[model samples]
Target: MKLLTTNTLMVLLILISGYGYIASCTHDDIVPPAQANPTPVITRGENVHLPNATGVADGDTTKWKLDKAHSSVLWSTAYVGAAGLLTGRFNQFGMHDVTNAKMLKYPTPSRGQVLPDTSWAFYENDPSKIYFNGYVQMNTSNTGEPGRDSGCILGTGYYNTVKIIPGYQNLEINNLAKIKTTKVEFDPLSNDYIVTFDFIWQGSLASPLTQSIVGRLKYIPKAAVKDAVTGNVLYSVFGLQLNFQFDCRDFGVTSTSVADVIDIECNMNFNNK
Candidate 1:
């Protein structure tokens, strides 16, 4: 994969299933919606490169602008999103359509640990304030290829952010880790940034810490199918909460320090000119 980006560097720190499936919300609460096609990786380009000097220095809240000219792809997970390298790119800007992605799990890895994860973060403006947000999905199933074919994790919600505090190497964004959604707007009314679409996140690789992983994502809301027996809508947009708790100090770890609130904002229109 290419080098990390500013936002992806921020999400440096930070799931389950089926009853197997946790039916927290019921449908029939909202009205019908329309559809519009957004930009995908395919129309984006064939490759991506990390421009020099775009990332923030320690404690710097410098904005990382999208180099629309030399830049092709938008998301940074472009490379990591896939497991094996492929011969071609897809129509959408996700991962290689046929390439296998690096599953984010390394059970009892000699060097890395994959928390029963569900949160991702990035340094806000400054390399200080980290935003953390993750909503656990109901089914811990496996989906196809993310933002591409049809799967990643076969679940209801998609949240991917894993920070290796005080990152492993001397990499500047080292101690930091993050990923960003497409550009969003600062909402004045809600007093919170709303990203209508595209959840963005990627992490410090810090070092080449590897592990075994099997997870699901993408909290896309679908029309709750009428129950086979009752013909009733079954799910709604419910606000379910999950706390990703882990004390790095307990693992004989004294390197990276957790930040305050790492808020992954949603509710913005991230496509188009």
Candidate 2:
């Protein structure tokens, strides 16, 4: 019952104010939990009927041109002792037809028009018909950091001299990494394709290394877009999702801080020409 001291009264008032502030906070004022990354959507071949190769010939000459705008080539590597991955991508690359001595090209659909249905043909059942020469521009390596990208091209620092392999140092060289498909086989169980190719890194310094990689090739014969009022198809879309890993040592990369294993994901889109 004794009168509270001035300091004690002030302390009590502070406590009451703190309690009132806490009581006034509602659910709306509380921060929500962080959200996990959303799963990517598969829009290339969503909900389309796959065509059968019943009448398709064994050596059909139909050509599917690559849609470079819709394609991507991403690479990642873990730091020697780090927990996360360092990812980057190539801004320039293309599929080539060595037999034709030219790069593959696709026709761009007009703003209001779409490619005809006959343009696209599926060759999954006949794997032999699926083949291409792939190339990557070494200078186009991008990691969102201009300095790091330049370092990657020069094979310096954490890149560990792996960016431009030996014998490819000539200024006149094309500065390209090439891939020539030697064989293609369809795996029914996984509904994917196993591709064996010569991954040519060094122009003449080393022999072509053979690597067998598996990739999912999704083909949608129908157009991805439709007319709002007429329901007419716009343009057909298809793509290959390829993920592979390789040791840097295999390509002469020997840095200790840089992980020996490098992962690559190439998402290639193609449109019927």
The lDDT per prediction is 0.24, 0.54
Q: Give candidate 2 regions above 4 Å deviation.
A: 1-63, 97-122, 152-174, 203-223
lDDT of 2 by residue, 1-273 (tens): 345687788899999999888877865498888998575332222232222232122233233455666789888888667897777887656554222232222233333112111222235567676665666655557788776665542233332223444322211123456666667776554556676666656422344344554444444343455678998865556666666666667666665656877787777666543
For each of the candidates, give the backbone clash count: 64, 0
The segments of candidate 1 whose C-alpha lies over 4 angstroms from its true place after superposition are: 1-105, 108-114, 120-222, 236-273
